[model samples]
Target: MVAIHLTSSFLLIRHFIPFMKKKGWGRIVNISSINGLIAMPGKAPYCFMKHALIGLTKAVALETAENGITCNAVCPAYVETELVMKQIRDRANQNNISYEEMRVAALVGFLCSDEAGSVTGCAIPVDAGYTAR
Candidate 1:
């Protein structure tokens, strides 16, 4: 549980933050999930990690913002990736929504760009309106 979700982000930030600090331009995009903001039934571990990831992103954002670094998170719901289709095709189909894969990349790309210089600690959703409810 800790290794894949929690520890990995922590370690990556710890390892590379200094380099970014040295360069004076850094962007951190943590890929959270809709479950992080809204819980999903029977997906306790996944939800927990994503929720934790949100906290991590927020803290990291505050810690590094003044250093010309920005940390934001992309929260996508049921993106049409191979892993999602393979694992949750039945449930996703039950939701009656078509695939929305590009949204995730689009949000991440915006967060990484210079235009979003002041946008940090945000859990931007790319969920095809799933979280709108």
Candidate 2:
């Protein structure tokens, strides 16, 4: 999955750079997760993959800067999406807790704070400041 994501992004950038250069402006935003920034127990693969995405974004941003192209990754924590619900369910099962309890705990642990918008090439933890504490 990581390979596919990275390869497709690279191919797209390669194909689009000429057009962007001609137009002299372009922005590429990659959606990453807070998990990409901080490692969580039992989620080694996710942590590894997200960190790789950040690295890829940084490398691409540097390579494309001269061409008026900017590549950035937006890291959001525990948004109220289906994916979050799935994670809640998984955690509930793994920890033998109620779904509601798991949900609240997850939110409290990972999604309770404002994001730092000024940081780049840095993991923006939208997980409610989970890393802050």
- Among the numbered candidates, top TM-score falls to 1
CA lDDT, candidate 2, residue 80: 51
Clashing pairs in 2: 110-127, 111-127, 111-128, 112-128, 113-128
| Shift of residue 35 alpha carbon in model 1, Å | 0.7
Clashes of 1: 0
lDDT of 2 by residue, 67-92 (tens): 66666665665545775788756656
Off by over 4 Å in 2: 3-5, 83-123
What would the per-residue lDDT of candidate 1 be over residues 1-133, giving only the tens digit for each residue? 8798889999999999999999998999998889889997899999999999999999999999988899998887756677777544555466665444434677788889999999999988776567898
In order, the Cα lDDT scores of the candidates are 0.84, 0.61
Please state the error at residue 5 of candidate 2 in Å: 4.2
Candidate 2 local Cα displacement, residue 105, angstroms: 24
